[model samples]
Target chain A: MTRFAFTVEFDGRPFMGWQRQAHGPSVQQAIEDAIASVTSEAVAVHAAGRTDAGVHGIAMRAHADIAKEIAPFRLMEALNARLRPDPVAILACEAVADDWHARFSCTGRSYVYRIVNRRAPLTWENGLAWRVIQPLDAAAMHGAAQVLVGLHDFTTFRSVHCQSASPVKTLDRLSVEREGDRVSIHAAARSFLHHQVRSMVGCLAMVGMGRWSADDLRAALEARDRAALALNAPPDGLYFVRATYPGES
Target chain B: MTRFAFTVEFDGRPFMGWQRQAHGPSVQQAIEDAIASVTSEAVAVHAAGRTDAGVHGIAMRAHADIAKEIAPFRLMEALNARLRPDPVAILACEAVADDWHARFSCTGRSYVYRIVNRRAPLTWENGLAWRVIQPLDAAAMHGAAQVLVGLHDFTTFRSVHCQSASPVKTLDRLSVEREGDRVSIHAAARSFLHHQVRSMVGCLAMVGMGRWSADDLRAALEARDRAALALNAPPDGLYFVRATYPGES
Candidate 1:
């Protein structure tokens, strides 16, 4: 028996998300089927994050256990070959110890949300970015984001269906920057509540548009209710950038 | 009569090309329909470049004549409102002199071709970039590109069906650079023979991959025969970045 860790990239547009569902295709099912084709084994993959539909993954980490012995590079080649037309690929494969887990061993994660702040309807990036007709004050949005930092109960910014044991999560960083006509929001943390990043970005956008204030955000956090939060940003703009482990750099 | 000059942006994935065709939708037809909806006058748009299918446009310039007087900014908004779900938008509009033409008045044009040089199949930029699985040598590609700069008979790089009377074109700049796993080829010129940029990029990519040599490229250019060049690069990776006029900043 051997354990292998794989770095993956996916479009997420055609799948029903990362997890398998009865009704539609998923990134997980695609990889699992590819593994079955290559190794003739029913392998279940454990990912560091379960991204929503229409989201994108640049460097998602996952792990699988297989009964057959194969070279790491060959494993990558076989999986990629079998995963055709699905817009998913295994970037790297490395043998790991039994205790090495893609999810449990992850110490840090980062995500980026994109917004095209212009009037022209999205052409190339139609389903890949949040297109806003009105201009957003990115500096003001960045200023409001500072209020949400530190250890706190993020109940107001979590999805109602979130199954996390606790709402308390420390947000290590939340920064907003502008380049040309696009606004990008980067968030980093050890772990996050479900929909936490999207919810926070949605509220910050309001502040950037002058629809909400910094004090309004503080009040929403203190409310400690899911209903107090603004709308969740669309999944298209969210990207699971990377997962980090200790001494893995 | 009023003449309006507009800058447009489009995804270009669905259209046949920039010019109208009887068999399929084109960017010109979409814009013409949108213009007729707003002004109730039949207008024919003339663009600086007639881009091929699957080629995106960041800031394509066009000119049209309308019978009624309309503010440039308002016309842009009205046209955008009518473009529907075709992924086309008017970025900006301005009144121009009757003698001005979209194609004739352009002093310079720039294009960017994006190639993803990595093992992972493109997820985030699936349709936006061309995926090259092998590693590309950017410095080598850049070096080879320098040989094609300046005035020359570009028949070897022109499409066989190109209708231009003369094959002589001057390339102002042909630069290749890489950022992480992506390689970008930027081409600038006062004007280009049809399919010149894509042809050059196709050959340069071959050189970068070591499948062809710099000497082969020079021989192809000097041959002055259409059949001397390699295949034209796919339109999926091409973008008409912008068209610059004499007085515009």
Candidate 2:
């Protein structure tokens, strides 16, 4: 058996989410079907992160097992050819050792959220951005976001349905930057609980809209209760950007 | 009768074009419907530029006549309220002299064309940008673009159906800039022949991909024939960004 890893890109608007559900289509099911079409092998692919509905992925990492002996790049080409009209593409493929699990081997993950702050309706970026008609204070949001950039019990930000064993996760980076009418929030960590990024963005938005102060965010972190945090931002604005692995620069 | 001049924004995917058409919906018809809904006035709105199918307008200026005395800002709000699911909006409105014409009073027009140069398929910016898989040479394209940025008879780039009385128009600016994966072509002029922006982008794209040289562009322009240029790029990636009028800030 050969273990192969793949980097994927997808527009998640059509799928229910990354995971398979009884209701609708999923990103994993699409890849699994494509793998079967190319290699005639039914393999369960493991992704580095399982994104939610309407959330996009730029370079998602996944791993699968196949019995056939094929070149890595050729496998990518075959899979992409079969995955037509789905808005998903296999960016790159590589052979890896059996011990390299897509989820377990990932050391860090990064995500970006886009916000279009303008009075006019979004033309080209209608579904891709979170539109905020009023002006936002990006500097204040950035200053408030810095307070959550360390090891802490992120109980207030974790989703109620999150399956993580513990709420204590080390957040390595959290930054916000503004360019013209767009504001981007970038977050990185070893791993994050489900809906954590969206939850934090909700709080940051409060600071941006002058509804909450920096001290309020710090207080929410210290409270360690979900009710102390703001509502989760919409999934349409979120993106699972990429994942990092050891010795894989 | 009172005349009002207004700035508008719209997502052009749903409309046939800026002009009112009998077969399908259009930006002009949408605004006209909204204006009649607001003031019970049967109005005909004239735009600064009549864009083609799938062309977006960021700040399209238009003028309409109303029988009732309505506040400019209130007229803007009323029209926008009626244009809700269609994604058309009136950004600003002001009462102007009855002689003011949106198409003739404009002193300058500016446009932007977006090109996404990358290998992966566009997820967030699918319809908003022109995705070119190969890497682009922005400097080369810019060098070639400067050759057309002055007073000239642009017959080589004019559309066959263009209604301009003369092909001679002064181009004030034609610049290309690259930021990461996005290559933007900006053009400014007092007036332009139809399809000028799309035709220029098609020529610039060839120079950007190293398929055509600077001298090739000069030869095409010198040919003074429409067929001398390459294919006209799609109208979906074109945006009429703004128009400047005399004594307006």
Candidates' TM-scores? 0.96, 0.93
Q: What DockQ do you compute for every candidate structure? A: 0.69, 0.44
- Which regions of candidate 2 are displaced past 4 Å? B97-99
TM-score of chain B of 2: 0.97
User: For residues A1-249, could you state the per-residue lDDT of candidate 2 as single tens digits?
Assistant: 899999988888899989978899999999999999999999999999999998988889999999999999889888887887688888789999999999999999999999988766655566677888768999999999999999999999998899999999999989999998789999999999999999999999999999999999999999999999876898878989989999998
* Top TM-score hit: 1
Tens digits of lDDT, candidate 1, B144-177: 9988999999999999889999999899999999
lDDT of 1 by residue, A1-249 (tens): 899999999987788899988999999999999999999999899999998888888889999999988999998998988898788989889999999999999999999999999887887787788987677999999999999988999999999889999999999999999999999999999999999999999999998899999999989998999989977898878889999988799
lDDT of 2 by residue, B1-249 (tens): 889998988877788999999999999999999998998988899999999888888899999999888898788878877888787888789999888889999999999999988765555455667888778999999999999999988999999999999989999999999997789999999998999999999999999998999899999988999989887988867899999888889
lDDT of 1: 0.91
Per-prediction TM-score, chain B alone: 0.97, 0.97
Clashing pairs in 2: none
In angstroms, give how far residue B10 of model 1 lies from its true place: 1.5
